[model samples]
Structure formats: C-alpha cells, structure tokens
Target: MTISCPTCKKPSAPRAENKAFPFCSERCRLIDLGDWLSESYRVPVGPDATERDGVSEDEAAGRVRTPDDLPN
Candidate 1:
C-alpha cells in the first residue's frame, strides 16, 4: 500500500523496502526527531494522572503521596 511520509506529507517508500518507512528519507526522519527533541512537537494530555489512574503525581514520579490528598 502507498503511504505518505508524516514529516513532509509526501509519498513514502513501502515499509518492506524502506528503512525509514514512515518518512521518505533519512533527512525527513531526522527532521522529525529534531522537532521532538526541541519540543516543537508534543502529545496533548487530558485529565490529571492521579484522577485517571489513582496514582498521584508524586507516586508517578516514584515519590510518596500524602494520604490527605482526597479525590474530588
């Protein structure tokens, strides 16, 4: 199946044939990585981690959370 490169939105090589399957070339792939390292790209987060998973920010970071932090 024909696919488009995520970085440049151009035609990309097939996964079986291309090392950089999602990108047209290594240049485009590195460009995408640079964007990530520079924080130019980000994934949107929703809701607090504590409310969602019952794991508080402290717990998530490997610290102890106080028992007094009640969920609303």
Candidate 2:
C-alpha cells in the first residue's frame, strides 16, 4: 500500500521498517514536529472541552482576586 507524508504530501510506500512511518523522511517528521512545537498546528477544542486538570485560564494566569489582594 502507498501513503503520503503528512508534512510534504509526498507519496511513498509505507513499511514497518520506515522510521518515519507517516512522514517521508526524518526531515519531514521534524518539520511536522516543529509545527506542533511552534503552535502552528493545534488540536480542535470544542466548547464543552475543559482545560486539563480543571484549571481555568484566569487561575492559570494568577488573575483570581482575593480580599487581601484587592485594591484599596
């Protein structure tokens, strides 16, 4: 069977021996990795999807105001 590299879309035969299965080569694999690390690629988050560990964005940013921390 034939498959295409997810990064460069190059068609090639897939084999278990291929180190970069979905990708054509190590270069293509690295490119795909760079995209993920750089936030160029993102998994879809639904409205119902919650943050991991239940930490809201405000809490994560330390924006939750406390009485003692309130402005005078």
Candidate 3:
C-alpha cells in the first residue's frame, strides 16, 4: 500500500529495501531523530490523564524518559 513518509510527507510504498521505511530517506529519518533529541518533539498527554488514576503526568513522563526505554 502507498503511504506518505512521516518526516518528509513524500508519498511512497513501504518496502523492506528501505531501512527508514516510514521516512522518505535516511536524511529525513535523521532529521526526525534530531528533533526528538532536542525535545522539539513531545508526546502529548491525553486531556483525561489525572492523578485519580494514581499516575501523574510527571511520573508517567519520567518513566518514559529512561534510557532503557529510548529507541536504539
């Protein structure tokens, strides 16, 4: 199926030959990585998130920030 690359928005089909499948190229893939490293990207917490669930936003964010949880 044809899909647009997430980083470049270039339309292409996902193929095993492309190491960066969701992105247009390695350049676009690296640009996305840099954005995340610089904190230009952030996972938005849902509006319904609350302490009532016994998990505050800060605590959940901390859990995700661990190096072990980071993509290789």
How close is each model in CA RMSD to the real structure? 9.8, 9.4, 14.8
Error of 3 at 13 (Å): 4.1
TM-score against native, each model = 0.51, 0.48, 0.47
lDDT of each: 0.74, 0.72, 0.69
Local distance difference test, candidate 2: 0.72
- Sort the candidates on TM-score, descending order: 1, 2, 3
Worst 10 residues of 2 by lDDT: 40-49
Best by TM-score: 1
Tens-place lDDT digits, model 1, residues 1-72:
779998889999988888998899887887788777887543323453235454455467875576677685
Residue clash pairs of candidate 1: none
Q: Which sequence of candidate numbers ranks them by lDDT, best first?
A: 1, 2, 3
lDDT (Cα, tens digit) per residue for candidate 3, span 11-54: 75567868787787777777777777887543334676444455
* Sequence-dependent TM-score of model 2: 0.48
TM-score of 1: 0.51
